[model samples]
Target: MQDNLPIRKIIHVDMDAFYASVEQMDNPELKGKPIAVGGGGARGVVSAASYEARKFGVRSALSGAQARRNCPELIFVKPRFDRYHEISKQIRAIFYDYTDLVEPLSLDEAYLDVTQNKKGNPSASLIAKEIRERIFKEVGLTASAGISINKFVAKVASDYNKPNGQKTVNPEEVLAFLEALDIRKFYGVGKVTTEKMYQLGIFTGKDLKQKSLEYLDTNFGKSGRFYYYIVRGIHTSEVRPKRTRKSLAAERTFNENLSSEIFMLEKLEHIAQEVSRRLTKSKVSGKTITLKIKYSDFTLQTRSKTLPYFISDKSIILETAKDLLFQEKLQNSVRLLGISLSNLNTEKTKKKLEEKKAVSVQLQFEF
Candidate 1:
């Protein structure tokens, strides 16, 4: 099977500081300045940071307070998802013109399979160039592209020359490139995993390739096999055109912690309602309801239960979340509450149920 595998032309495109860039593009006053797109409160987190802010060691998911400490001049702007979604659609349209096999990881990045493209472009690198140019010309934002034989290498290469650049790694250079890559830079290798890999004497791809599959499996479980193949530039995962939504969730943090159970329950009710609203809007329902609690001390706990039937109603979600919440004793003052629904009903299943209900209603009218 390995010998029969055909080389594919894959490109990964990533928008540079997408939200911040969009904000700057619309608001001329924000140009050439450090800005963060998110709430700038004590408990708020940065969603995206301008390149200028990044130089100050600011980054997405970093605490707003810390981002402020890094760059005092940093401007904070609220995220406009509607505008971002519109931009994303424009970018995706460009991708579809090149290849229908476009897999969006998020609003800011996507992978494209241009092995057999709509434009009949032989060179994936050229396709990537055109896409980037079109994005800038049409969308008024710059994107970086990485072209390679596979998605993993392409994703890593795209980051090599960022903001407004592109990189292509030929098949012959794949091994050499992977060998020099820092394990920390490998996709899916988070900070915790990187630290674990370092402790196990795997700091770079070279070090990772030195280990046996058995050794890796023993150390890292199933993901060990993934690392084993990826280091050899042997990733076989295709660029899936459709990625399923596995869950829906909503959460909120309070300005002040609440020690009373009644206060916590009230907050949980609100979170549940939000989650249900999202689920309804998405036309999804789930059997599993999870309750997440974050204490004032920053400790977190989650409790979940799976119901026999799928439900997206707010009352049911609220009740289930309340049950999950009460099942666990409060260890500390609650600072945040969250609810998520999983074990989702597929779109086909939802549609079938809707059709069945329609049929039942028609039968009642005939009587």
Candidate 2:
């Protein structure tokens, strides 16, 4: 996809608290209160929780009981997948009004390559905002947008202003914005890498850029090139709307059956560093961080942490994995451990004005 001279104009549309917001929009009385979708049974999981629920630590994937514990006044609702999908289809159809390079990630999100938009509008951000407005007026939903020169920055920028808020990442300011960013916030750094970066004096974009390619290559091998590229805002990665992820993780299975906290931590840290490096080299980030452990009896325990944000940093990845590890009950001597990353990154678009199409990150995530 990168071989051509096609500098594609792409947009990523993400529904805000999609399921919860849908419930709230459908029932005005549910607005402004803690709401969670999906609480039918023991196996029932929270599909989406409102901002109010978020304040109480209620979140998607949490058991119904856990969510109630987090927020006593939380209101639970069932998922309307069919309805949500219908809304998604309606939103995607709107994309067709602009371009055919539309790729749907799910019922709540999609990436549209509007480089040669059908409307010939010349402004992806304009298209993004218009789409949001259309979704609200037609489908009765709210969305957030992020527009930028590339899919990576655009998708990241979308989250900056969410729940109907819009933000733009201008080409001239992309560098400074990235420079001031925390190392952990980078698309591929992961949790372990973030901590290591802290230990190695790499806290921000400037620190990451300061590290010579030789140093990064020596330490991180293939990802060294990517590190340099992103720091300079020189990414050449293409946005293929139809791409799916492969090999989501790279971790180690401990060689010995031991449980020394410090030692185990060191081992996980090393694994996270390797994984982060690999992710950057591959130009990917996983929203799910999985932890695998096997006991001396050959019994296995696995845990996963799904992030609201797509990340590729080792430190964040490791931290989440570590938390998952602690969440589980260990019954025997630790003999093995593994880590994997999933829910990879994809293209996203934003709402932008026609004149600001050159480079703009949609800051629209307000509800």
Candidate 3:
């Protein structure tokens, strides 16, 4: 079975508590102590927590007040996104030194396909180790890595050993490793799906593999096919080198919910401007504009408009957002307002240019 599988070397690299670790690395006093990166305010949520903070049950998305309750000594440091981006670029440079087939999942993690690495090294595990060492030595941050035959197992393996460590799942070990893995740990399976799987008596990869293709499809839909193959260690998704941004967005959660429609419209204007600025900075526009609203009671709603053409103009975005905002009556007092642009034109321009070049080449040949 292993001999029939196509050979590929995939590595998933994830930084250990990225934001909090960066804080500790820069501040001498924060080392060896529990720290969190976010505002420690009434409505503030923890963005990242150091391992020390994690020991006390403080974690990302936990409210700042709750995080403090978890660890009385937890220190909150405001996030430095600019600094993090700088460090992320440095880490990517290291990845590029090894392989151009690097797919960044976020500012702190990425997938690297080193089957044909620039370093001419055949061992993916060794390349992962070298990448981690370079990141620590150059950027003063530690990264954990998972090496496997495919991205699914590689991503799962990466988290098996966290905080400055690496794990490798060789082709021969893929089946055994996946069979023993908890069903909840399967990629793309979330909380609701896990509960559903448990109700269906699917508790592990072995149990999942026992389900027929038609049975999985009937139960889980299209994702059932994903599970069907992934359980057998078959994932053919390649590491995309230039993954385009699907959307550009900006949103704000207010300190106080506003009941006034005027206030909401005013907030939407600012949000639209922010989204437009991001679209311009990214040099991409989109046809779909979505307005996300979160009410005081925490219930969320979204309204969207897909235009005939892509646009990054702030005025147009603001007008469209205003239309969406006023088109519906207020469901409740709003606490958060967000504007996002999607269905981006990142590849459209490239495709158009390629067509123009093709026409030019054809004309030259005719002459």
lDDT of each: 0.91, 0.77, 0.92
Span of 10 residues, lowest total lDDT, candidate 1: 1-10
Candidate 1 colliding pairs: none
What would the per-residue lDDT of candidate 1 be over residues 93-184, giving only the tens digit for each residue? 99999889999999989999999999998999999999999999999999999999889999999999997999999988888899999998
Output the lDDT of residue 115, model 2.
72
Each prediction's RMSD to truth? 4.7, 16.0, 3.0
Q: Which stretches of candidate 1 lie over 4 Å from their true place?
A: 348-367
Model 2 C-alpha lDDT per residue in residues 311-364, reported as the tens digit of each score: 888789888877887785577778677888876663322223233554443434
TM-score of 2: 0.62
User: What is the lDDT, from 0 to 100, of the residue 211 in candidate 3?
Assistant: 94
Listed per model in order, the count of residue pairs whose N, CA or C atoms clash below 3 Å is: 0, 54, 0
Write down the worst ten-residue block by lDDT for model 2.
346-355
Model 3 poorest ten-residue lDDT run: 1-10
